[model samples]
Target: MRLWFLIPALMAAALGARDANAQQVHFDIDATLPVRDTELPYTLDLNLTAAAPTRIGVGALLDLREIQKIVPERMADNAIVDNCGLQVRLDDLSFQAQDETIGLDGGVTITIFECSRTSERDFQRGEQKRAILANMSTQATVDLRNNCAYFKLVDLTLTAPEAQREQLLEDDTLDSVKELMLAAVDLVLNETPLCPELPAELASLDPVYENGGPKEIGDGGLGVFLDGSVDVSPSTILDILTVLQQRKLIPGPP
Candidate 1:
């Protein structure tokens, strides 16, 4: 990812003012972040302006499929498998961005085995494949301290096919099965931190935000927006110098 930082020339006027504490520097960043090892593009637009408390705003759009890639293909709890008498494996994962939620399609394979048979040999009975659909409401948060973003789950619902729903109810394990699949999805989304590689110059700015960010879901992806600020005081300058020196982008003092 390449980040372009545009600092307005007017900021010099503040630095020259009598009140040093009133001086502030603004930053504008626009960049396209490519998903790791993939050609997919994630757009990011951020703005931090000078104000009484300083203000920052960010907008980002990431393809939903890229998020699917991060989730594990095989996630099965041993206890659940044993109690349910089924071996589960997540075969494929797909996603779609809806009006206010992201839709998930998970292809799952279940192997039914004889629970009564303790023998390791020939205990398998048969296999069945099913498609599970889910819709999720989420919120985005920017973590400048960690230099990353996180998706927080606001709500989740399983929209299973009618036939599968009947089967699930008949099997008397609907709740357990739903819990298992949802847990897998939650693990990948909420627990996993998303850190987009940022240029050292932008990273050194020490971006900060106050509240939960806003997001838009559409165009087959998730768009996250954040408003925050960056300090430009002497301490901030020193931090930038330290970062540049550590990255060997500039010479360090002897």
Candidate 2:
């Protein structure tokens, strides 16, 4: 009897120790987006670190030279050439994590300022226009712990304010701005040529159309409300969530 009681106690203590160690760790994530309607394809990669309850950092790399190549030829009328890479930084994160979920106790933020290039045609004659190529990244402070993986980005606001959109178009580029807005949303959602179906509300955003296609309303911006979220996890988390949840991590839903 005495030995049996001692065994259980010892096991409990060992598990608690393991959970603490797993809480803080570093991770890496990468994915490629599909070619959206009239939009260039690109790849995204990032490094991140999590230190307990609310500290997270996301380092990023992006390549968008394709967008620049197409604009000059296709929309020559409202043409301002833009081509460059992007860097998405997300930090100051505060969140709570549970089994297969990480909820934002604090909002996540990602911003890309006026960080793109313009074509020579943009500088010709009385050309007084500048294109602000940016895709603001949203923060993910949602419940994201399931098994040993982190939560994947499932969604981001798919629209930009009208004022912001106008600011992005320099010269004739603005003429095609409405169409490009859909492409911009496609870039963020990693929507490939085979872009997946979005949630219904997102699909029905347009008052005059509903091809389940991306659209713009009132100048806010064009966006792709993704069908789901992103999943991210470091190795250390598995040891902790396993011990804390008192169960094995289930694999993806059948």
Candidate 3:
């Protein structure tokens, strides 16, 4: 089956900023990420050569912790609004800046087995909607990079899929999906990082996905965060990158 694997965005994110990134020192870090029983953890055989990798598995764990650090002592009670409402009291994400990596170096190959929830979902007879994501438990090789870490994915293999839906492994389906994923990774790795453009408020109570409505959600995305955050964390930067993608602010790198 030819599944439309969307990378959750306005446009497929691209690799960019090569010239602006030349002078910096690079680090190549590798790791074996943790995985759920049914899911296949990726062995990030990353060859960053000279860029910092955004280990999503690592970022998710770290970011979650960071966000939790600032949960206000007495958070304000959420107010109910009309229609769809999501009340998220976000604390400023806290991370020890010292933990950041500067680059990727050395011939490294790391395996990651991330955790996943295995369950059978009953698809409605006439419905064709399916969701494929989970909170991943990732592990990595500690401190291979000297200081700053540049990231790369040399070879990554995902080992989990729906057992009953066994058609995913037919022919080049897995390779095709992996290629697309790594392309996005290389885009970020081989260049300067895509910085988030958070608002001055840092956090807010806002109406999400108000404009897109419901029907268009599947075409690209339509949930509240779909405006941007649907793909990236907090969905804020996702909005910024969407504009950039539309304007071609970040062009593709060779």
lDDT of 2 by residue, 1-254 (tens): 00111223223333333333232221122223333345444322222223223223232222223432343344323222233322222223233323323232212122222433357544223332332333323333212122111123444432334776554344333334334433453454342232322223222211111122221222322122112122223333343334323422223223
Task: Rate residue 166 of model 1 by lDDT.
Answer: 76
lDDT of 2 at 14: 30
Tell how far residue 218 is off in model 2, in angstroms: 36
For model 1, state the Cα shift of residue 240 in Å: 7.0
Q: What's the lDDT of the predicted structure labeled candidate 1?
A: 0.45
Write the number of the candidate with greater lDDT, choosing between 1 and 3: 1
Candidate 2 has its poorest 10 consecutive residues by lDDT at 142-151
The CA lDDT at 57 in model 3 is 11
lDDT for each residue of candidate 1 in 173-215, tens digit (9 for 90 to 100): 4466556645654555454444444465556556555433334
Ranking by TM-score: 1, 3, 2
Off by over 4 Å in 3: 1-149, 162-165, 193-254
lDDT of each: 0.45, 0.29, 0.25
Worst 10 residues of 1 by lDDT: 5-14
Error of 2 at 106 (Å): 42
Q: Which pairs clash inside model 1?
A: 56-227, 56-228, 57-227, 58-226
- For model 2, the stretches where C-alpha displacement exceeds 4 angstroms are 1-36, 77-236, 239-254
- Give per-residue lDDT, candidate 2, residue 7: 27
All models, RMSD in angstroms: 7.6, 18.7, 23.3
